[model samples]
Target: MGSNEYFTEAVVLDKEPSGEFDSIAHLYTQELGRVSASVTSARKILSKLNSHLEPLNLVQVRLVEKNRFHVADVLKTGALDRQHLDALKLIKSITPEAQPDPELWHLIKTNLNEKDILSILGFDSQFAACLGCGLKKDLRFSINDLSYFCVACYDRLL
Candidate 1:
């Protein structure tokens, strides 16, 4: 509750070792979107903060936002399967740092599956058109035309 610290839920999207004892973490958070955080002494065996800092583990974190965010403590953790972890890595690659997208957050929270995430990876003109037109339901992707049409749009085209 200090002025320098705030609490929110986040998922560890990626991480890199910092020096020998610290780590830099990429987090996608419910309240702040994507954030890069410094975890002090994360490589030390005695560091209690290391356990909650794995990729794809949703955690409640206490973050201090000064020059950059720093992880003060991890209060809770959530689970995901291996497939979900892979999909999250994909999301991290395409997502802009420090930008918050609630739609993407919802997708990660509820609709993550191999098929759903694969489509995101292969997203082409057709997929873009469907999303642009708000016709993502009943999707029929036409490779030849490079377009996607919903049932109603297809019927009209016919």
Candidate 2:
């Protein structure tokens, strides 16, 4: 492969229309943590890349980086359920670009829970207590505040 070309396993995070016939795909890749790549003519009706690059799909992708990254090819490897799609969204929200974390990648590739993901992001919940009631049990994490709150406290806030 050329120096500017990269091949990696990636999970599709999201996609958005770019111009008239192109799209910008957000991917969390095993080799490059997160990247946005342009897909030429991906908005067309017969776009093969568009179907393979749907949100939460696991794919092998070839990316060419010139002034910016562009998708050269993609092959769908797996499809994730709605629950996993939610996890992918959380991963996209937390991770930075081009900072690959093998542990995080493994967590995404396998059966995972929110706790595992939060731990990978350095927010361990084992010793966490409710911010309002100081109770650890039956707590839900608040990403907005980076705190845990018991069900009662959380319900009250909502």
Candidate 3:
């Protein structure tokens, strides 16, 4: 590896075409948190990173950090299902840049269930507190309100 280049495990969050042939990929890494990497010639037919750069794909990437990250190599790759990919998108949409949370990483690596979505996004404590004065164990999520409430509180609102 070059002096400036380093390898890290990352998950692809989004990608946007850049210039004519290059592309920029947004990644959430275990070490560097969220970063945008430049994939040179990414739109070309022979681009190796093309197959590994899709959303929700876990990859081991070699990067050099300058004004923006430049991808040197993609060492490995893993992918999620359509539903899990959607959940990952949701997670990425709300996540801020350069913030690393091991809990979130673990959730992405292990399970992609919607039930864990709230917690994975760092809303569990707040959701729990929203449930009937903050002491309810059987809290239910409310899509309409975008929060959680105990059965009694949920009933009262209805």
Candidate 4:
């Protein structure tokens, strides 16, 4: 590795097109927390990094930092299922950029559950109640307001 380059374990949170062939990938890294890195040629069919950078995949990434972070290489370390993908989405939504939280990282790497994630983020489920009706049954968390709502109340807003 070059002086400017470093490697870390990361979860591919999301990716979006940039310019034409390149992309900006959002990664939740063990060392760097949530980071957005530029991935060159990511949209091209034959790009090696494209497949490994898919959302919710656990990867070992080589990143170079200059004006901004850039992904030089990626190796998929683990493939997560759909349920884990949903948890990853929630993690992406709540976490801020470039702030490493070891607790959150461990949660991401383990048997993930919403209650534990919420607790690590400083939300106490014991006091949680539906924002619409103040009932606690069948509560689902809303990332938008960092609160909980019952299933019926949450569905009503949709």
Which is the leading candidate under TM-score?
4
Q: What are the TM-scores, per candidate, against the unseen true structure?
A: 0.67, 0.81, 0.69, 0.85
Task: List lDDT for all candidates, in order.
Answer: 0.71, 0.85, 0.75, 0.85
Among all windows of ten consecutive residues in candidate 1, which has the lowest summed lDDT? 123-132
For candidate 2, the clash count comes to: 0
Q: Which 10 residues in a row give candidate 2 its minimum summed lDDT?
A: 40-49
Higher-ranked by TM-score: 1 or 2: 2
lDDT of 1: 0.71
Error of 2 at 47 (Å): 1.8
Report the lDDT of model 3 for residue 121.
66
State, as a TM-score between 0 and 1, how close model 2 is to the true structure.
0.81
Cα lDDT of model 4 by residue, 1-158, tens digit: 34477799999988888876888899999899999998874355427787898997899999998878999889999977777766777888988888999998887887777788888888767888999999977888888878898999899877
Position 108, candidate 1: lDDT: 77
Name the TM-score of candidate 1: 0.67
Q: Write the per-residue lDDT of candidate 2 for residues 44-145, one digit (tens) a residue.
A: 532889999999899999999988899999999997777876677777777778899999889888875678988888877888899998998988877667
lDDT tens string, model 1, 44-150?
A: 54166767778878889888987778988885468666778766766666556766677667777887754454364465434454533566577655433445667
Predicted candidate 3 versus true structure: per-residue lDDT over 88-125, tens digit per residue = 66666666787887877887788766567677665674
Considering only N, C-alpha and C atoms within 3 Å, which residue pairs clash in candidate 3? Answer: none
| RMSD in Å for model 1 | 8.6
Model 4: lDDT equals: 0.85
